[model samples]
Target chain A: MPRADARANRAALLASAAQRFAIDGADVALEKIARDAGVSIATLYRHFPHREALVAATYAREIEDLAEVPDDGSGSVALARWLLRFVEFARTKRALGDLLHAPGADHPPARGVLLDALDRILTRGRADGTLRDDRDPADVLALLAGLWTLPDDDTWPVRADRLAGFVLDGLTTTR
Target chain B: MPRADARANRAALLASAAQRFAIDGADVALEKIARDAGVSIATLYRHFPHREALVAATYAREIEDLAEVPDDGSGSVALARWLLRFVEFARTKRALGDLLHAPGADHPPARGVLLDALDRILTRGRADGTLRDDRDPADVLALLAGLWTLPDDDTWPVRADRLAGFVLDGLTTTR
Candidate 1:
């Protein structure tokens, strides 16, 4: 396959893997993921040599997604958007928890990446006076740790949204 | 022993149990607790038949503390004080988690009590125009769930305080 085609196939496989793993759990079949990604099992295996490889790759992509902040012109808006994305990331992370925490899982530095992302948004917000300067990004992140503790049920998304709103309100300056 | 003396001894045992459990784990020696409470082993046993009983009683007392909101005149101040007390409760709850979650352990209705306490404060705050009327007490409780997710260390108190501050700021009305 050409390099571009291979890259596209790889990205497709990762997206499928993330969705399937979240819905079906870490033990989800590789063939199902390949089928969902519109690729052959051989192609999936070529991109990811093993199940752990696929999981690690999916997790890395999620972190990268979080690190890429959307510039909405206003710091508060950007941070708010980023926080909603973080909620999605948190949901996926919870689904991947058992596998991620399994012994010796090699993945990117998720905490550092998330903190860097928050710092970026906070820095911009502070400069624009849209966010409170007294709040630390680390503290904001720590407060959000509640996302992991929420019950996984039909109401999960609503609860997650409310939690994010609370954090956002706390971070934003009173204008 | 007289009724008043028995009551004082029981309260002393509970206080010592809460302090010791926070410092030590759930399996800490009962003898140490009895000594700390200045009561004999028989007296401790009289109040609490078993270790589970003691843990349950301690948890009950913690919930009661949370339910008893301080009338600081301002609803925000009252809730703020209650929240600080809540941090302490969360810490003890974390320490007592294993015993509390053990099979068939009976305890008071913690969630109902906490929600009722929050409702009381929020009602006053909303009436006095000190807190945001748009916020739900349940959502506030859910947001404060982050308290349970924090790491237990020296910095735990500081992080807990920050988390409480964030929730309080989100719940309080802007003047």
Candidate 2:
């Protein structure tokens, strides 16, 4: 295969691996994943040294890239919008969240980067009078944990949004 | 031993077993339980034929008697007080909750009776204009699941109460 083609294949494999792992859990076999990705097992192994590497890379890819935080909105509204997006992420990323929380799991790649992103959004919200100055990012994270407590029913999104709104209310004093 | 003394010893043994299981989980040994309760192993076995039986009895006993809900207050206030008490019960009776939730565990003893008691409280609140008329008890239980998501710090009770208030707000429709 051409060098560029191989790199593209590797990227495709990584993306597919993440989706499969998120949908089917950690025990999903590499053969099935490679097959689904339209690549061979040998190619999968060449790109990822092992299952953990693939899992970590997939998770790193799954986390939202923070370079897109809006620079031109009221901070509180932007923070609320950001938290709503995060709640959606937590609800849909259940499999990734489970992996990150599993006992004795390896650290996901670029965890610091993710935390830094969250910190930046929160700090900007506080500085701009959008978010309450008294709240910690950790507390906000803890409240967001409630998003994952959603039931598997038709009303899940509605209920999760309501709970997220409550959290937002608790975070801000003036709102 | 006298019959009354024998009954007292049996009661003490079960209480100790409940405390141990709640604090240490289901894996605690009978011998250790007997030692804690100052009872003989044979006596413990006489009262409870197996760990499952012991677990069941422990759960049943903890929930069999709850403090009476005051009839004089508005339904919402009454419901709030009742939920606080229930949350306290959950805090102290962690083992019962664990047994009920453990995968593949047998049906918990007297769950129907306990659930019925809870339903009555909610129904009374609804009838008396304390709780929202349309809220389902099942949804209340699901939302209460968020309580366990609280972080294990000294602030847990305070945070848990706030979460309960958030759910109560959703359950009510003041507007």
Give me the candidate number with maximum lDDT. 1
Model-by-model lDDT, in order? 0.76, 0.65
- Judged by DockQ, which candidate is best? 1
Model 1: docking quality category: incorrect
lDDT of 1 by residue, A45-70 (tens): 99999886788788886667778987
Candidate 1, number of clashes: 0
Best candidate, TM-score: 1
DockQ of all predictions against the true structure, Cα-based:
0.18, 0.12
The DockQ-derived docking category for candidate 2 is incorrect
- Error of model 1, residue B141, in angstroms: 2.1
Worst 10 residues of 1 chain A by lDDT: A98-107
Show pairs that collide, candidate 2.
A76-A130, B75-B130, B76-B130
Q: Candidate 2 regions off by >4 Å? A: A1-57, A64-68, A97-135, A169-175, B1-20, B25-57, B64-70, B94-143, B165-175
Global Cα lDDT for candidate 2: 0.65
